[model samples]
Target chain A: MSTASSTVLRGRVWKFGDWVSGDDGIVRFSELRNFADDHDPAELARHCFAGLVPNFAERVTPGDIVVAGRGFGIPSHPPAPMALRAAGIAAAVVESTDTAFIRRSLNAGLPVVTCPGITDAANEGDVLEVDLAAGRVTVNGTVFAVKPFAPAMLEVVDSGGLVPYLARYLAGNARA
Target chain B: MRQTVAQKIIARAAGTETVEVGDYVTVTPDYTVMQDIYFYKNIKILEKLGVHEIAYPDKVIAVLDHTPQAAHGSIYVDRNRESREFARRTGFDNFFDVGRAGLRHLIMVEQGFARPGLLVFSDEPNISSIGAVGALNVPISTEVIVSMVRDSNWVRVPASVRFELVGSLPPGVWVRDLVQAICHDYGGGDGLIQRCVEFGGPALSTLSLDSRQGLLAGMYHAGADTALADVDDVALAYVQERADGRPYEVFTADADAEYDEVRTWDLSALEPFVTAPPKHADVVPVSDVSGRRITQATIGSCASNRLDDLRAAAEVLRDHPVAPGVTMYITPGSPAVYSQAAREGLIELFTERGATVLSPGCTTCWGYLGALGDGDVTISTNQEHYPGRAGSRKADIYLSSPYVVAASAVAGEITDPRPLLAREGKPHVHS
Candidate 1:
C-alpha cells in the first residue's frame, strides 16, 4: 500500500438517513425502479435509480467518501451495495451499518467504516485530510474528532476491501 | 468478578486465560465478510493507493447484496455506477448480484462461507444471526473490523448490560418491534455499547429464525457486541453443512457469569405494543394513543414484514373494511413472503377490504414509497418512525405491532390490541 502520511479526499458527501441492513438502497442512483412494479421487492430494488438524477456513482471525485446518520440499509437487499461499489468511490464511513451491509460489503471486499458519532463533524463538500495513524480528519487545517479506524478496518480501507486484501495475501503466500 | 457468555466465548476462542468481567481480549479474525457496496468503495480506495491483492481473499467473502439498483435521481445513479465499477475493477470472483441470490445470512450459510467454532465479525446485526446457526460468533465493532483485518487477535472485553427476555411472544409480533420496545423502555445509549447481551427465557423458543434475527437487530442497535441464544438441532445441522474443517465450538455463560445489570419481563403479558411519533420504537400503549385518527396504516418491512406477522394482521382485517377514511397500505417483505400471504388469501383480504397493497419491498417505510401529504398521520409496523420515514417531515407517526396496527386500522385510531384479543377469541393480559 502506498504510504502517504495524509491525503485529502475531496468529493460531495452523501448522507443516508436510514441504516444499511440488506440489499436495499444500493441502487439509489439507477433508473427509478419501484418495488411495486414487478410485485417482487427484490427485483424492483435491482432496478433502482432507473430514472433518478445525480446517481451516487456520478457524484464522486477519486477520493470522495459517503456518509450516513444511522441504520443505512435495513431492508437487506444484497445488490444494493454492489451499485455503490460499482461507482468507484474512495471509502464509506457510517454512523452505523446493518450486519448485512457489513457482511456483504466485506465478502464483496468492500470497505465500510463506522464510528459512534461521525455525523457531528464534516460537511457535504468540505475537503478532508485524513491522518491514518492519528485517526483524525482535517478540514481547512482544523482537525475534527473522528473515531480512529480499527487496524483491520484501516487495512480494508487501504486494500480497498477484503478481496484485494486477500488477493495480495494469497499471492504473497504463493510467492513465499 | 463473574464472566458473561461474551467473556467466556471470547476467552475460549482466544484459548488463553479465563476472563472475568471488565477484561478485554484482542483476537485474530477467524472469518471476515464484507457487504459489497462498501467493498466496492474500499476497492477504489485500494486502487488509488496502488495496492493490489487482498490478504486472504478465500477467507473473505465479497457480498454485493446491497444497493439492489439505482433510483431515478442522478446521485443514486452515480452510486450504482460506482458500485458496478468497483466490482469490475476489483475482480471479485464470489460476487453475488441481484435476482439469483438470497439474503446475506442465507447465502453465506447456503454457500458454506461461515462455519462453527470460529469467531466471526460482521457489520450488520441480524446478519450476525448467521453465527446463531452454530459458532462462537460475535459481531465486532465496525471500526475494529475495518482496522484490524490483518490482526488475528483482539482484546476480549466484558459487557455490563444484561437484557433478559422472558415468556413467549404472541404471533405477529416480530423481534424488531420487541427491540424497538426494549430501546423505548430502556433508552438506547452508550452504556450498552460493548456489552454482552444474552437473550433467553421461554420467550426465545417461540421466536422463529426471523424473530431471532429481529431480536438480534435490537441487540445490535443497542450497540452490544455479542448475542447468544440457546442452541438446538436445527442450529447444529445448519452449522455442520458450512463448517468445512472447523470444529464446532459452543460458548455458554458459566452458571457464574457476571451481569452488571439484568432486567426481565414476561412476553405473555406483552400486548400489541406501539410507539407514538418521533421514533419508530419509542413505544406507548395502543390504548394511550387510540382515537388519534390515524390517516394511514401499513404493514411490511424488515422489522414487521414476516409471514407470521402478515397472517396475524390478515386475520384481523379479513372481511373488515379498513375503517372509513383510513388509507391502508400493505407491502410484503419479500417475494417469498408475498407468495405465501397471497396463497393464504391474506393479500386478497386486505385489498378487498380497501387496503392498498404495495408489492413486497420497503414501500412507504422508506421515504420513497406509500407517500403521504403534509400533516398526515400514519400508523405503521416498522423499525423506526424518525422523521422522513414516509415523507412529509411534518407527518405524525405511531409505530405498533402488526396486530396493534391492524386493530388501529379497524378502530380508525390507535387502539389497544386487548379488545382485538377478545374479538379474536383469545384471553387478554397486559404488562
Candidate 2:
C-alpha cells in the first residue's frame, strides 16, 4: 500500500460512508459524491445500486481509512452504509460525516472519524492515518494539524459508530 | 486513463468540436419533456414554425399537470380550453392526461419516457427530477424550453456550488431536505443566481431514485441549468427510449471533467435537514429549526410531492391535528396520485390532520392558486423558494421533506422529526 504526505492530504484513498449499502445485498453509487455534467444518476444508480451496493461487506478489509465529506448520510432508503459497517469492510470512516450517518454508524458500532481537509490530501488508493485526538493526519507518518475534528465525535467512533453496538441487544426485539 | 460514459456520449454526438467545460455546444435533445402550460403554447409555436406534422413526434411527450382548476369559473375554462386545444392541435398522441399521471418527471420514468444515454431537455426547473431513474440519462434545461428545442445541446458550464458529499445520512432526510439546507446555507433565494451547482461524491448512490430526482430539481438556480449522472444501463433504458434514432450519446469528460469548485458533504453525519423560506435552495438541519410557526404550508409541485413523499407526510400526520393557526394544503402531483392517495387512506389522514387537499395540479409553489395572502409564511417541498412563488412576493417559504413539513404542521414551527419519531439507536453512518 502506498502512503501519502500528511502536509497536504496527498494520496489516493477510497471513502466509505454509512449510507452505501442496498437491500439486494449490493453496493449503491452516490450521485452527490460525483459531479459530472453528462452524468446520469439513474444509470449510475443501476450500475451501482440497482442490485447491489459496493459489496464492501466482502470487498473492504481492515487498515483502510475511509475518507468522507460532509452530509454523507442523506439517503432515504435503509440497508446502505449500515450493512457495510456491520460487516467490517471499513476500519475507520473519517472526514465530514453527516448526522444521520453518524447516528447510524454509532448504532452499528463502526469506527468513524471526522477530519476536515482530509479529502484534498488523499486520492483513491492512498492509505491515510488520521489522529482525531491531536487533530493531525499522518500520511506515510508525516503529520499536520490541518484541521480539528470534534472530540465528542471521537467517542461515537470508539463505540463502533452505531449498529454493532446497538444490534447485539436489539436483534428481533419488539418496540419498547 | 479510461473515458467515462458521459465523455463517450459527448464524443459521439459532437462530430467536430470535442465537448468541454464552459464550451458552448448545442446538445441535441433526444426527447423533450413538457409540463401543462408550455405544451399548449408549443403547439401554437409549432404551428407558427409551420411544421404540420412533427418530424419526430413519437420522441416528444406532452404532460398536462400545471393548473387544473382556477378559483374563477371563466379562468378555469380558459386554462382548460388552452390545454385541450394544444393537445388536440399538436397531434400529440403521447399525452399523460391529468388524473392519470403524477409529476411529469416521475411519470416519465414510471412510464419509461426516460432512458439511458438519451440526452433530454425541458423548459422548466422540475425536469431535473428525472435523475432518479438510475439508468435513463439526459440534459435538463433550467432556461426556457424554446431555446433548447431550437438547438438540442445545452451549454456545458462549470458549477458554482460544488458540494462533495462523503457521509451517510438518515433515512427520513432526503435530497430535497439537503438541497433546501444548501439553499439555506447559501442565501436562500439568490445564492445560486446565474451560478452552476454540481453535486458529487461517494454518498450520492445512497439516495433513492425519487430522492435523486428531488436533488436534481433542487439544483435549479436562476443562474444555471441542472444535470446529473446517467452512467449505466438502468439509466440507458430511460435515455434510449427517448432517443430520436439510437440513444443520444452520453457527454462526459475524460477522468478529468473540469470543475470550477468542489465541496464535500458527509451523509452519515447530516441531520434530518430543512431550508426555511423566501429561498428555495437554502438548507438547514431539521433539528435546528422545527416547530417554528407558520401560516400556510403546502406539499405538491412539478418537482416534489410524489407518492412516497405523500406517504411520508401521511405517516407523520397519522394521528396529529394541524396546529391551531396553520393551514396546510396537500396537492397531489396529478389526478392519479390523488386517487391513489385516497384509496390508500392518505387523503383521509391529511384531512383528519386539518389539512386542505386541493385538486391535483401545480398550486402554491408554481406562483399559482393565490396560495398565500399577505404576510403568509409557507413551507413547501418545491425546488426554488423565490419571492412570488406562492402568489405573494412577501411570503416566507421554507423548503423541507414531507416528514419535516408534516411534523412542523403539528408543532406549528420548524422542528425536526427525530424526537417525535423517537428512533432508537439506529446506526448513523457518515462517509
- Weakest lDDT window of 10 consecutive positions for candidate 2 chain A: A29-38
What lDDT is reached at residue A143 by model 1?
A: 59
- Number of colliding residue pairs in each model: 169, 167
- Which regions in candidate 1 have their CA more than 4 angstroms from the true location? A1-176, B1-3, B8-26, B30-37, B51-66, B77-94, B101-118, B125-164, B170-177, B188-191, B221-226, B237-248, B279-281, B321-365, B371-373, B426-431
Residue-by-residue lDDT tens digits, candidate 2, B56-98: 6666776656655544753445655766665577665766675
| Candidate 2: tens digits of C-alpha lDDT, residues A1-176 | 22232211222356543223222222322222111112342333333333333543344443444565533333211234444443433434354432223333433344345555555656657666655556567665555463343333343345344222123212432121
Candidates, DockQ: 0.07, 0.01
Interface RMSD of each: 8.9, 21.3
lDDT of 1 by residue, A2-74 (tens): 1253222444555554443333244531132332111243443234332332443344445565666665544
Candidate achieving the largest DockQ? 1
lDDT for model 2: 0.52
| RMSD (Å) of each candidate, 1 decimal | 9.5, 21.4
lDDT of all the models against the reference?
Answer: 0.56, 0.52
Q: Please give the distance, in angstroms, between residue A65's alpha carbon in candidate 1 and its true position after superposition.
A: 23
Model 2: residue B225 alpha-carbon error in angstroms: 1.6
